[model samples]
Target chain A: MIRLGRKHLFEDLPRFFASLGGIVFAVQLVVVQLGIFFGFVHSSSLLIQESRADFWAAAKEMQYLEITLPVPYSWIAKARAVTGVAEVQPIIIRSIVFENSNGALDYGRVVGFDPAGSLVHLDDHPVGDLREIAKPGAFAADAGQLSSLGVSGIGAEGTIRTKKAHLVALVHDTQPIISPTFLYTSLRNAVLWSPAMIDEFVRDPFTSSFDINSPLNFVLVKAKPGVDLVALRGALERALPNSRVLTKAEMIDVTQRFWVKRTNVGFILGLCAALGILVGMVVVAQILYTSVNEHIREYGTLKALGIPDRLLYASIIWQAVVMGLIGFIPGLLLGLAVAGYAQNARGIAIEITLPITLEVLGLSIAMCVVAAVFAVRRAMTIDPMIVFKA
Target chain B: MNEPRAVIGDSIVMTYPSAAGPVHVLRGANIHADRGEIVLVDGPSGSGKTTLLSILGGILTPASGRVTIEGTDVTRMPRRERACLRLARLGFVFQGFNLLRALTARENIELPLQALGIRRAERLKMIDALLERLGLADKGARRPAQLSGGEQQRVAIARALAGGPVVVLADEPTASLDRENGAEVMKLLCELARERETSVLIASHDQRIAPFADRIVSLVDGRC
Candidate 1:
């Protein structure tokens, strides 16, 4: 049966492959949609990678980074006091109107960090020195903001009008999470620009002073080697009753779950992908079943020549498997191509990695085998005696 | 004549289920043939001539009685075992040539040998010899769609002989060919039967092939 299976594929592969265009297209749609959905999920967690912090401490019940409550800046000092604490950086986050030179206005995040903070500068490439950011009226614009705001060159000057800060450096990292029209300034400069922020928190003694209009959102923490992360997290959670402590990996997962799993967008896209795969399976089954019926006499003739039903059944399955493989190669390649084009056109981060591509290929082959089983059963049950009847 | 290489059935009776009732297609049909002998089965339509041939060839099982080929009781064997016997010891030339449309002449001839599990080198050798014997060496690479009707029939004969079976059952083998091509095909069947000492049983209504058979069994109303 295996030998016959091989011959069957070798003899009929060209015709089989030529007839599978519809199935391939259908499968490709499912795979590409799934890829883009995964891409969106990755985009929502891009901040975790860009921040490069070992751990994050935020207010308890934080659902998303953008919406989480600010913890006290004093927590930075307390966290740094821990035995294995390598560094502690405070990050203040607030949204403001971004005005382009042409008078077009957009909303973007304004981030305030200490000049020497590790959270503000990426470890791989430091865009601006701590001394540069500490200089009065100095601020840096992320590359994504420079293009969106129509500002050009490294010394491009732009204003964070609401905070009255001047953009001095154009930091080049096209990462959308960090660079999408964000204003980066030193913590002192931020307070100087908006002096009312200091008094507004100081007057409210009952409320935490850090809980002002422009409050601290996160305190990025780096831990030394051999420190038990779980133990550290438990200790921090006890000390800061109003805050939630999470390792970097946990924070990334929370971000993904918040923006992707909990959102309706993932559901809609995932449903469409599943429907596409179902359609592809139906198309393949129908075509293989019809081909089997059309070639009944041939099957009977083979049977009459002493070929067992098992061999005949294998031939039909081999044909289907060959069709699937033929369709899958092109479909897999085209799906990735479409994903790449969509990512470029929409400027949305869609991850289409090698592992995902291989997974889709394996999935497509399994679907083909399942469909072939249905068609082959129909072929095998045909009585050999039919060939001799008149 | 040599010893009877093919044994006739012993009071074979076959009944088929019909919408109206049970329909008996063959009733006590008997046939016999010696080595290198050609036996012609002739009857009108629905007279069970083809049915008798099918039963004798181990393709259709009888409700009662028995069929023996070279002393093997094919009627008593299991379906798959009987099919294996048919493949190993019997050959069939179907009415319509029944050639696989996608395969070329040589590939079609090589099919039976492939079923017999012959090695590739040996199967190709037999296929080449058979095609050359049938004067179809030039047409070996052409598909059935590319060949003439007579050529297709010849390929069917080549397929039957490829496995070197002891007996050949030809059902209206030349029904679609012109007189000249028909005669040529008949001559090839007779020649192969004589040279290889293979028993030949041909079921046909064509009187033209009557003179070529060594014995003629006439059937009527499902009786012989």
Candidate 2:
């Protein structure tokens, strides 16, 4: 038979495009909002996601990576003693303020780990020797934050916690979300710079005397090849009861959840995405409802000809699907453009991956399908005999 | 010999609820048409001509009456079955032509045939013949707006007959046309109905259609 729904949708060009515009607007809004939300989640958990460690042992009740209480440095040997444990390395995380030569100060995190023993993966964007971070006062900073930190390049000097700090390498893609700028260095420098470590021990920057007894943030653990991580995690957890032993995946999940569930920014972005879907739904529903009323008389004629109500409903739904598929193309394209601008200019990473693209498309189609209900109900109730009236 | 009764509506009564009260449109209307017969229902405005036709076509339920089409009682049939019966056995032509503006002439003629699950090859063959018979051969691709009023009516007639229904009901089929076009439509409709051995019912106040009817039944004061 004739494609009644498609024909009806296109019969009035202005109205048809108006409906499409509504769908496009909805798809665009959803794509951008959710895209940014995912970006935020990833950035907040970047270090954990990039870790090569099989498990992460942190202080008990550690909800966030940076805000955790210090894990006992004694956990290193305890974790190494567990079955299936290949190695353990202590890592320190402390928030510190740094000053440029002009006295402008900004905040940054000190991420210090034992380079020889740590299981953490080397960052792909760093442009210098990783081993050099073991040198006294040596650090790496993201190039993106150099101007804000009042540093020029690899050889620039800055002060952290009243101690002279030298930038030994330049890194990229370290744009921070919840945490501030990152300063990557050796564990000795981080320990000397930490206020807690310095207050507990006599200030001795030259001696560089820190041992396994020092309080640290986390311990990265590596499992023997082919070892069951679940079993290893249980052993480690039991061995270090004061620390939480989590698999790599579990640690990433916990960090992402902490940022998304506990922060106002995440909640606001989520609400904005929901509102976009709602707006799109209303737009499609109103457009379809109006289109149905405009063609009410034709529907009556079809009904009089004994066309099944189900077929009529199918026609209306077909129109909605067509609108969704057609509108999503432009919406996605626009969203990608906006995402790029946000990442480059605003420093807000919006990663619109293939999976995210498919998800948004599915949402777009579902929104249209739900919106078709009103139009279908109206079409079904039309009186067929009205065609008989003069 | 008496021809078989293709359609019958007896003592059909219809009422509509109004703010004032329940306004009765038809009371005890009775009508019948045999196979291959042309029946004209004549009446002034509000004389229940449309109401009687509505009842006979199973579009409206009568307060009290029985209707049978080719020996099948449709009055008590469920709405879905009544719709199926209409699709299989009845056709309607309206004053406004009632053609979907989005479809071409040929597609409109294919509506009922498609509804009946006819194959595409057979539908094309049938539509080609119908278009030729109705003098719409060259205009099959033109939408309703592109066709003139008379051509649109011819397409409507072709649509009604495409499924080879047993009964064809025309309600003011020519009311939108001029006198010349109206007469031509009536002549073609009556000829086609007779040639197919189908019953034709025309409900209208137009006097020009009287001469072509095999029988005329006057509906007045809610009775026929």
Candidate 3:
């Protein structure tokens, strides 16, 4: 039976390929749309992965890194006193508008960290020199920002008049460090340039928000080896009632849920993919239906010769499956090519996992089976006596 | 005539229900064919010759009466059962030379064997022998579209006989061919029946084939 199925498939190879052209085109549309959605979700989480932090302590109800408030700068000293805590650092984060070479304004994140502290400078990538940022008005920018600024190396100078700062070293492709256009500067410069910075360190007389003395948006905490994260989380949650301390995994989940899950992007992309599958299925069903109709007399003849309805049904299904595989292979390859092109041209990362590829192929084949089954209803109803009448 | 392999119908009455009313296609039609005999059913168009042949071949069920093939009552069986019996014991050649357009001559002949679950090697050997015998050995690889009317008929006949069925029914097998091609096809049908000892039944108005039959059954106004 398998051999017969193969023979029928091979014999009708031209028809199968012609029909598959539609299926492949449909599948590619769905895959590429889904890939774009995935790329967006992945980009949102890029910073969290690059941070390489064990835990983040943020004010209650922090949705993403950019939206959170800073804890008191002195909290670093108090946190260091806690047992099992390796180090503590204070950092300032703000979003500001900067002018491009074309005089167009673009929004970006500005990060201020202490040059000498282990907590502020956590990246493993080599920074030219610590003293460079120590100079007044000096700042560092990510490669994306540098490119957008139409500048060449770390020595290129650019100004953020909104923050009254000057760029010094340019960090290339440091994604999570600053998502949009991150500019790094010294803590002293951060405090001096921005009007939003509070001078008192203890309290803010104007705002009634959480403790004003808190100097960092999050205090990254690393536990000693062999320590249970669950147990430590429990202890920390109890100790710090004013803030939330979450493990790396928990933070990732929170970020994903808050950002990716709530966004309409995934839903829209998924709907597009579903529509593509539906179109492919319809195309297959119509092609099979027409093919069966065209061979009605042949079917009658076979039936008159003692062939059972079950075998007849099997033959029709076999043809469909063959067409599906033929269509799917090229569809899958074309989908990958489209995704690769999109990623290169638009700077979008589309990750093609093995399981995902297999799943797509399986889905395509299943669609073919469904289409074939639709045609089987007509094939099985053909009367063998039609041959005798003819 | 040799021993009878088919007792076609006993007082068979077939009525088709159309929008107008019940139209009787066959009335008390009886046909019998002995082994190795060529039974030519002669009738004008719409004279119920095809209907009687259909019932005899187990391809149709009469409103009343029964058709027995090789001692099995097919008309009394369910439609699926009748179909299976027809496929196993009877083969048909239609007027259109109904070879599958997508299949080659060899593949068309192999269709019935495939349905019977015959192995590829065995079916190929049988197809080769049948093609050689029909003088179509060089044409087996050609699709029906690539063959002439006479060649297509021969391929259809080869397909019908490939399974070595007990009985073969042909409906106007020479209707689409010229006189010369028609004679050739009739000769092949007669030769196949004699060589294989199978009952051959042909329903046609062509007088050229009448001489090849061992018996002639004349059908008129739904009666034979």
Best by DockQ: 2
Q: Give the docking tier of candidate 2.
A: medium
Kindly list the per-residue Cα lDDT of model 1 for residues B1-224, writing each as its tens digit: 55545667778788999999999888777677777789888988777877787788787888987888887898989988987887888888888888888778998887778778899999998899989999998999999999998989999999988898888999888788999999999999989888898889998999998978888888876667
Candidate 3 per-residue lDDT, tens place, A253-351, comes to 776566566667778878888888888888888878877786777777777776787887888888777777778778878989988885556445665
What is the C-alpha local distance difference test score of candidate 2? 0.85
State which docking tier applies to candidate 3: medium
What's candidate 2's DockQ score? Answer: 0.73
lDDT over C-alpha atoms for residue A22 of model 3: 70
Candidate 1 C-alpha lDDT tens digits along A1-390: 444445445555554554467567766886787777777677666557677578888877578766665566567767787767788888766666666555666566666788676665533454545357677767676544555666664555445554445566655443443224566667766655433344434222234344555467788888777888777777666656667788888888888778675668788877887787777777778777877777778878887777666667777677666667778778877887887786556555556678877777777777777877877887768776677654
For model 2, residues B92-191, the per-residue Cα lDDT tens digits are 9999999988899999989888889999999999999989998989999999999999999999999998899899999998899999999999999999
Q: Regarding DockQ, does 2 or 3 come out ahead? A: 2
Q: After superposition, how far is residue A275 of candidate 2 from its true place, in Å?
A: 1.8
What ranges in model 2 sit over 4 Å off?
A: A147-152, A197-213, B1-4
Each candidate's chain B TM-score?
A: 0.95, 0.97, 0.95
Arrange candidates by DockQ, highest first: which order? 2, 3, 1
